[model samples]
Target: MAILATEGLTKRFPRVTALDELTVMAGTGVTGLVGANGAGKSTLIKILLGLLPPTSGRARVLDLDAATHGLEIRRLVGYMPEHDCLPPDVSATEFVVHMAQMSGLPRTAARERAADTLRHVGLHEERYRPIGGYSTGMRQRVKLAQALVHDPRLVFLDEPTNGLDPQGRDEMLALIRRIGTEFGISVLVTSHLLGELERVCDHVIVIDAGRLLRSSAIGDFTQASQAIAVEVEDGLEPLVERLGGLGEAVAVQGRLLTVQVPADADPGRTYDAVRDAVCDLGLNLVRLEQRRGHIEDVFKEPVA
Candidate 1:
């Protein structure tokens, strides 16, 4: 079942159209919302969260109408905005507990849940420190902690890795994966970096200029291409000539030769032909593997 769905959703600002007839369905698990800046990713999240009303069309969250059940939807969904929204004077524990209470938790229960959530997010003794004293990674964790503290069924994480170093980004990504896989909470994570999502998302939805570009499983997005790359220890020129003579479209790049495997031809035959060509030229095969497609490939196509 889909946790979120949109039909012909459109949102317009005073002079710009943020979302233009966007339609998409997101299932349970980690679904990535990928697009460049001004691609309508944040606008879509706002609409789905019932914070912004669309100019046209309809949207639903957890099978509830976003237009009519905005308050109810907010209760079940947690949001971590892109920009820093934390209060610098308050400690992480205090802020999280306050958020839980605002979400309708009693004082005692909110404190208990906040403590457990802070621990789960890897915030130990530092969680009691004021937000102004925390590092970038620790602040990100505090943001994540509040989102999960309310025991929300779903979370919308917008640019969770913004302004972090390499190590911090890796840790945040791992925590996001754990939230979806280990905790079983459906996640809609938005990021401008396309390659990063490939490692964490089960499915991806690409949007360009507020329009749906492509939506599919992550595996389908990065399926194997129709070319195989071959590398040899020596006799590069001879192997290229031999492979070209065998009716293969070959392109040389430094020490590697990329051969196009014909669609109508057997793939195994291509592998065998490569092996035979190397053997005939007395060259040692170093590596021969199909060049797999990447999530970035989708951006190369014209927007639909």
Candidate 2:
């Protein structure tokens, strides 16, 4: 099912057109909403969630009209805002339980479910501690716990790793993956970093200047293309010269090398030739893999 969708959706804020004729779709699993800052990613998400009415066009959440069915959608969908909104006075246990009860669960059931949700999000004994004493990662988990406390069917995670460290980011990403695969919750996650989303998202939708740039499965971005990526410890100057002399389309990126092979030509021969050249030169072979385009490649020139 299409968990969320928008068609020519637009939003205007006095002088700025936050979103301009934007369209997007989110299916089951994790769909990545990727764009740089001010690229209209947040505006598009808001329109679909019915938080802001679109200036033009249509949007739907789970087949219901975003304009008319917003109330119903709110019950079925969970939203984890990008910014911090935790109450400093209360503990995670208290906040999540309150959120669950507000979602129509009874007090006892709400508290019970809040405890389970907190644990599922990796918050243990510290959950009972006051929010004022929590670290950034702990606070982020509390936010996530509240989002899931109501047992929502679909979720919108807006930069869940925004302020997290490397370790915290990895932990949050794993949690997001599990929420979709293990818990059966469809998710639309946003990130300004294109490469970061590539690691965790099943599909990616790139947007630029409030317009839809491209939308495709992750495989399309990482498919075996005509370019080959070769890496060695050193002596890339000689390798580039040798490969260029041999009439192979080769280029260097940082410590790695990229050799473009012919479409129908045998990659094995190309690989062997590169291997032999490195061996003959007595250079260390670090790695060799096929070169695939990334989300940033979509922006190398134009998204068109």
What is the C-alpha local distance difference test score of each model? 0.88, 0.85
- Candidate 1, residues 149-206: lDDT per residue as tens digits? 9989899999998999977987898899999999999999998876777678999899
* Alpha carbon lDDT at 180, candidate 2: 88
Residue-level lDDT tens digits of model 2 in 158-198: 98999999889889988999998999998899998766677
lDDT score for residue 267 of model 1: 72
TM-score of 1: 0.78
